[model samples]
Target: MDVAARLIGSVRLPGAAALVTGAPHGAPAGRLALRRGDRLEVYGVAELFADAPRPEAAFPAPWPGWDRGVDAVAPDGSFAVFSGQRAVRAVAADGRALWEHRHGCWGPVVGHPHTGDEQEVCGGLEHGSVHVPADGRSVWAHVVDADGPEHWVVLDARDGRETARFPLEDSAASGSHQFSLPGGGTVLLCVGMGQDGVLLYGADGAGTPDGTGPSGVRDLGEDLDRILLDVHPDRPVYLTVEHSCDDLRVHAPDGTVLAGRDAAELGEDRCWDYAAGFADADTVVAVAENGEDDGPGHWLLDAHSLAVLGPVAYPHPVTGSLRALGDGTWLTHDRATDTLSRWRRAGA
Candidate 1:
């Protein structure tokens, strides 16, 4: 009932401070997005797992105009997709713009429905960002209209063409996250920060009829403060931390609670890290803290059965979040050492 990981390979990045954006579905299998200073670099997963790891491509952060939010590197490492205040752009490796789509200004002054007071409200993309799935064919962007309705647009990665669009429920601006389904389809989950709800949108591959549409939307009851963590790599299930990390729950796209466990029931007073997600189709890897000065601990759960597989003690303390590679391995960045390391279940 114990899980163990080994240091497969590591890459030292520049800058004292850096951010690791887990590789999306469409990018090359082992590629990772490393943001240092105003620059973003794509590094090979294979290389990071090699005896000697090196970066595959490095470029300035995309969408340099305003504050940069969500972004993805193209699969072939030739281009980058970046999101701005109200636009998403595709930039070439040489820094030339390939295409751009500008939406409505994010924070528009709107009158409060009941109070009759005008206030400025913005959508999540202003701080969060879009997702680029694995096929590398299109980019999924959550865009807000000039009049205030929000829509999810799928754009062609090649030319930024609008291939499909799905209108979402009216909700205040909040961050977003997406998971790729078994096929080339994707499920986009938007977290309404102020509205206190989660919206789900689905889009089939290029050929399906009426592929992009609202799949399910739910207002998680006020008693439960939940955060969407990760999606099952191969199923229609997603993970969330409930009651501010007191418990973990597995949910279906239609808002069905598949299974869950409370911290006390797990024989510990640990708070699950909302940033954790599925390490594979049937397994979820999360971090937990027992209110001790000792660094956080890792937990492996049965994604289907909600069975706790005991705690994992890595050879080295994982300082940052855990991102599954969608393969059997995962990635962890140790800022204390400025090293990006690839990990796999020992003997996995």
Candidate 2:
């Protein structure tokens, strides 16, 4: 089966490298954020498809020049949290350091003694990720410690105080990604270990003030290669693509596999790409490229049952993955032209 895609609209955001959405259940559902160079550009879903005017607002990155570690802008775009080599800092738009929580260096060098020089640690091959929940009152980070162990930590957004932490079991992490669940306080972390495999962990905490509460980490499983992608906009479920592109699965907040589809079901020698997302409550847009294809193939899946609905036939050729805006539309990035195009099912 083949489903046609219509070009709803497109915007040219020079240097825009990434896309992000708030918790599936977060408020202001039509808003989306983009990482453009050293800043973040926030725009409303309606604006992107209609006016394509200047962004609603832009927030400067906490670490302006260093792009090694991952960062997340607040839901309201008031502040941004930077997961740096030695510390996680929350900074405002005016470049004010609201707070900083120091931790071990994420660099590979042992006892390297980071001297606060971005260039010194820019060569490191490893890094971690940070995220802000929907409430924007706390920050979740996955970082390495001085004792050579990675830990998932929750920090108070107001003061940068460590509220809770748990050391991870996997140590051969090349890097990781952090995702915030729908309700706001829960989070999921996916760690990549080069060619070995990937690790997934969930951290639950209400962002308590006393640094003590119902906070802990749950290991999704061992010898896992799943990469957590996007969460359901109206549910606590999330999407994941197998590291080797073998399959795509929808998972509950507690890490239970709700539904899955193998790459073999797509075509001969076909594999799911590392990216897939919930276009809306009942639909998922995924990419699966087979050996015979000249480029990646886009497909639509039943969000609940993970059943292959059909391939997504675009009006014109598109490249790379689609980033779901969670408002019944998805976006594709064209690196050759530095353009971000939004699309939807034709006649939808």
Candidate 3:
């Protein structure tokens, strides 16, 4: 049967990359973060979806452009942490300096002279990202050093002190991003190495099985370059697509494959896109494209069984990748008009 989608609500957000939903440990339940170039606009989730879009607060990001760092907004939209080449700094919403942790620069040039603190490097070949867990007490940062391997460091959210650090053992040429799991106790890290491949890692926070601090980092062993898309809103299972966009799979917290579907199961000559994710607990919304000659297609699958339920029938044309909200709704951004839209199953 065909799964139809209804336009729930949409708002025009210029240069909006994506909408950041609040987790219990992150933003407030009803607040939403819209990430633009160098700042974040916080809005009420209900208000933005209700057609009355007004920014409740604005959080300005720190130095270095978006291309050089992977930053994140605090849970209450009070401040933002930027993971730059030479340091990971936290700045208040009012542009106040909270704290900073300095490190080796990620600049690719070997033996790059460290002239002075005043010297600035704009664009670089390598970079990293950061994530604030649900607990919002510490920041998980991926940083590259000029002399050694890349490391993942846990920083004290209040004073910018380093609590824990681990080497990634992988080279990143295009930077990376971190996804804070719903419970705020675990996180998934994805590092892009340009043409080489992608790397994935997982770690546990405070509430460890043995009441330890945070568990050691574990590599997901992605020989096929798996790109994690999303996690179950209430569970540890996550969604990922192969780097080649050939298949989509759901995996357990321990990196075990729960279920999966490939292009052969989707449609003839159609491959899965990397933007697929959990539309809800029981539904997976994915995009499959049939080459550049054909328009990109959207499909729904049984989240548990990984069965292809059918394609999502939108009322009108919707462009861009589907970003599932995991609440029986998803979002898509029209690059042409820079409009962000939210949708749900019709008659749902």
lDDT of each: 0.63, 0.76, 0.74
State the RMSD for candidate 1: 5.7
**Model 1 off-target regions past 4 Å?**
15-26, 49-53, 59-62, 65-67, 76-78, 107-125, 147-149, 192-200, 203-226, 316-320
Candidate 2 per-residue C-alpha lDDT over 1-348 given as tens digits, one digit per residue, 9 for 90 to 100: 789999878777664436522122122346666566776566676675554466776666666666666677787778777777778888787778898888887767766665666434545668887887777777778888887888888788889888877778665778777777777656778888879888888767574545763366777755567887887888888999888989999988778889999999987899998768989999999888887647888899999999999999888887577778666788888878877788898878
Candidate 1, residues 1-348, lDDT tens digits: the string is 667887776766554133334323234455667655555667666765565545677666554444435567766777877766557778877778798887765654432232222122243334335776666767777777766777777787778878777666655555555555545554444444545654444445444223343233334333355666667767877777773678888876555689997776655666776557777776777777777777667777787977888777579667556676656767677877777776777777
lDDT of 3 by residue, 133-186 (tens): 766678888886767578888888888878888887765647777776666666
lDDT of 3: 0.74
| Poorly placed runs, candidate 2 (over 4 Å) | 20-29, 48-52, 113-120, 213-216
Q: What local lDDT score does residue 124 receive in model 1, on the 0 to 100 scale?
A: 31
Superposition error at 176 for model 1 (Å)? 2.1
- Report lDDT (Cα) of residue 101, candidate 1: 85
Steric collisions counted per model: 6, 0, 2
| C-alpha positional error of residue 190 in candidate 2 after TM-score superposition, expressed in Å | 1.3
Candidate 1's error at 204, in angstroms? 3.9
